[model samples]
Target: MRADRLVSLVLLLRQRGRLSAATLARELEVSTRTVLRDIEALSAAGVPVYAERGRHGGFALLPGFQTELTGLNHDEALALLVAGSRRGAQVFGLGSALASAMLKVVDALPESYRNTAAGAAQRLLIDPETDLLARRSVAEEVPDTIVAEVRRAVFAGHKLRIRYAAADQAPKWRTVDPIGLVTARDQGYLLATRSGADRTYRLSRISAAQELAEPAQRPERVDLDRAWQERSARFRTGGDQVTVSVRVDPARRAHLVDTALTIGAEEPEVDGWLRLEAVFQDPRHAEWAVWQLATHAEVLAPQWLRASLRERATTLATRYDVPPGESRPSRASAAATSAATRTPDSTAPSK
Candidate 1:
């Protein structure tokens, strides 16, 4: 811990120039006497650190001594410097500081190296396609100020009063003890609880949130990342998992084996196609997933999924009203019908 403190003290001095001994001691959780000893050790090692004795007394490095920049080779230096010019640099206020540091490095370079480094810098470019602000907008619907307040509540274990909006539901006011903020696609989600029930609310949908003066009692520690992963796994499992057999087109079958979803044994099918056996969690996820290889896959098992897909296909077919005489169904064939509404001429059997 003392070594850690010493390293921190040196880095702080390098970055901030000076700091009061009392302040350093408080920061390192050590006594002023130890801080003085640490300063002495730094000075003894040719660190050029010194202490002033009176009203403005603090530890500082002797004027004009900067760390030599010889540690980094040309490519490494170029990468580090170019990273600061990337699109998100403004988010951390690093552009100007990086430029200044790069200049110092250039000034310290031998004349021979100076030209080469400049040419390498010109060849390298860091262009950020997405600005930090735009990327941040995808994570949460709310502004930075609101996220700040929510973070404070989460970290402090405080109960918050929030006005929330849900999809197609009337806005409701509620009190919840915030557990943590979840980030998805650059938006912030508040995962919290009210009366022992957990809920998720988009930060964008929150309005007029305020933290209470008194903090609520909570577990000493909560692992938010673990909770998110477990919940995602469970949600995937929520849908029925059915054993299925499908015939896939030759062109689309390879993509099947390459995907993350389970694919069972394959067997020869008609017209040189292949039949695949698999189990999928949700029909909804399956539908979307298979759509990616639309012409390539044909569902063959459990009957219900095939029926569902057929119904969905019928609906889509009716939308375009395929002409009756053509290879497709008549345009009106897409019209939705069921046992309750089917005419006698309709081939759809009555229940």
Candidate 2:
């Protein structure tokens, strides 16, 4: 830890030129005494660190002294900086570590590339709270201790015991052998197995976690990417997957697949519409996705899904009190019906 702090301190000096002892202490979250000792240690090790007297002065690397972190070109340094700017690392409790690492990378770059890399990275934006369309993609928060425990079990090939608050279920204790950890957006997941059954636990939902003493019952060598893909495929195809064959208008055909759990085979009909075999999360999911598209999308099969949609539509139709046998009107139909229902006298001034 001291070595990490010392490296971070050097990077700060390399990036900002000279910095005061108090500044170093504040940046490193250490004391001025520690900073002084590190400076002395650097000098003893022939690192060319020197102190300057007077209020405007502090510790600095001698002119032209730069750490040799080579084989990295300008683009690589910029990429590293931009990546460091993201909060994905923060979700796993690596925010401070990422910052320190980024500092070392920038400091190690060749002098000619360092400033350009820094400036170029500052121009790119990622994962802003509100995106370009002003829509907030809210982030999930996980406790530091929970993620640290989960990460430890994953990387160290150990089992983990967790108190998890599963969605729609009461909090319960579970012991699992962690396979890997995955982060998407700002949320993290623990991909693990219990009794050889694959399970995924959202890291944020873990109220408490502890690394188990027993070694994990897992393969010695794992291809995490392959394991994740296999788990995902199983999850998508095995869960309460509902298949809904649908006839969707051309305009809504693309939209249908956008919201589906899986898009199966599709065929274009002679009527200019496409009949698609769409897989949805469940009946409720099928109903919700189709209903949003209204008459533009029609559920054609898997009687249960069709029935569910019809039930909701019938209820919706009743809510509006349209005469029985009068079909629900879409936007265009409603406009035409509105015109047909009115008389010329209705628009004329009364005598």
Per-prediction TM-score: 0.46, 0.67
Evaluated with lDDT, which candidate comes out highest?
2
Worst 10 residues of 1 by lDDT: 87-96
lDDT of 1 by residue, 44-83 (tens): 8778888777887799876667665334333234335445
Q: List the residue pairs that clash in candidate 2.
A: none
lDDT string for model 2 (1-351, tens) is 776777787778879889999999988778999999999888887888888999899988888776653333332343354364367676777666666767867776777999999899899876687877899866688877787788778878988999999878999998999988776667778888899988888888899999998998888877877877887787777767788888999988788888897888989999999999899877677888999999898877888778887878876765588876777767677679879987777768888
Assess candidate 1 and give its lDDT.
Answer: 0.66
Predicted structure with the largest TM-score when compared to the true one? 2
lDDT of each: 0.66, 0.80
- Among all windows of ten consecutive residues in candidate 2, which has the lowest summed lDDT? 70-79
